[model samples]
Target: MSERRRQFDRDGFLVLPGFASPEACAGLVAAAERIVAETDVDALETIFDAKGQGHGRDRWFLDSGPEVRAFLEDTPEGPKRVNKLGHALHDRVPEFRAFSDDPRLDALVRELGVAAPRLLQSMLIFKYPRVGGEVPAHQDASYLYTEPVSVIGLWFALEEATLENGCLEALPGSHRLGLRSRYRRDGDRAFTERLDPRPWPRAGWRPLPVPAGTLVVLHGLLAHRSAANRSPDPRRAYALHVIDAETEYAADNWLQRPADMPLRGFSTPA
Candidate 1:
């Protein structure tokens, strides 16, 4: 395994500097703009594309919508899947190739006691101003029901991720805890009311500070989330989800099986 993997295994995640570069980030942003522009907004009148738009059923997102449509978009009864942003980003870029692969990332998983590794889902999470919101403190594995929590996520920040603009905060070594106590479903929560996420209180909360082109790779069981975008400008991050080869596609979760498209660090799975 690569030294990068060693760092991740020890720290739950690592922030690699300049993974893509400003030029590459610009390319991803431009590609996203094209998708929004070409999208048929009129066809999609009352649309909603917040978080996990497509789980069991396909989500409806209009070309120009500030937020979810309240009714249709809220309450994720079905499995939660990444929204159109993921689909578009995956369709455009070609730099996300080694984010999940490479001898390092692959070895890290194998060393985790899992057999082979296969990417299950990947998506781009763009944060809009004002309306774009915060993700509560919770573990990524909570939403993922697959036992063993072998699935992990790679977060690629396309823009400067600062505290003012809402950076991702992770609980150091949270992955070692192995799916920290889950929470019961409350009507208030959106998607993750079913699982435990710090059902009790904790200390030593840390926020990740990484600039554009930086990648924050974490274990699937890691506890982390981000705040709302408060910066005057927009912040965008491409969230790519990868699963171990031993994992089977359970009928319950949302799956992103994009066609042979060109995306950075993700065109081909290792």
Candidate 2:
């Protein structure tokens, strides 16, 4: 086995520094800023409550699986603070598609044991200073579940992620703990269904602070969370979730694309 695969198997995650060029990171940051500037908050009704009971599920949030949409932060400071732009930024946005479809990603996924990697979801997260909400401990498999649990996440830091700006915190070898819950869609409503009663272990947890061009590879079941941003600098990141196409995607998964719009691989044209 390759050293990268061995490390991922043992740790459930990998930190690859300089995976993206500084210019690439800066361009993505500028693109995200432009998207936020152009977003019309007056028409938006979904306040993204990351820590709420519903977990930010709504018509706008649930139906954004196949398209690009903006979600606001759950803060009294009003609706201008966009928590993230998500679900299909990689397939719809030119800048994001270019960044996500790099040849390096294809090779990386292959080395990680994914025979055919399909892009499941993508998000441009904007943890605005002071108002960025906390993301609780959770696993990616809970959301984008597959029968055998074959999903990987590539999280790119568009800006330097620091402890002060709410960088990712995770349990080192948590993927072996099995799935804790599954986010299911029941018609128009969506909710999380518990699969395990045991809570995430607090021991061996660590904060992962990385530079702007760093890429954090996460196993699908890795328990991870981020605190609310308290610093003046914003924590901006781009995340892409990919799954092995050979696995069976749960039919009732909350985020589902239209039949016509199938998931694409890294080398596929947008």
Candidate 2 residues lying further than 4 Å off, grouped into runs, are 53-57, 77-79
Which numbered prediction scores highest in TM-score against the true structure? 2
lDDT of each: 0.56, 0.89
Judge candidate 1 at residue 262 and give its lDDT: 18
What's the TM for model 2? 0.97
**How many Å off is the CA of 2 in candidate 2?**
1.0
Tens digit per residue, CA lDDT, model 1, 19-128: 77688778767765565566553343222333443332334322111121212212235322222354333323444443434465555456654575665445556565
In the range 1-270, model 2's lDDT, one tens digit per residue, is 999999999899999999999999989888888887787877776877776645435888889988888888887766467888988988988999999999999899889888899999999989999888899999999989998999999999988999999999989899998999998899887888899999887688899999989999999999999999999999999999999999999999988899999998886865
Local distance difference test, candidate 1: 0.56
- Model 2 has an lDDT value of 0.89
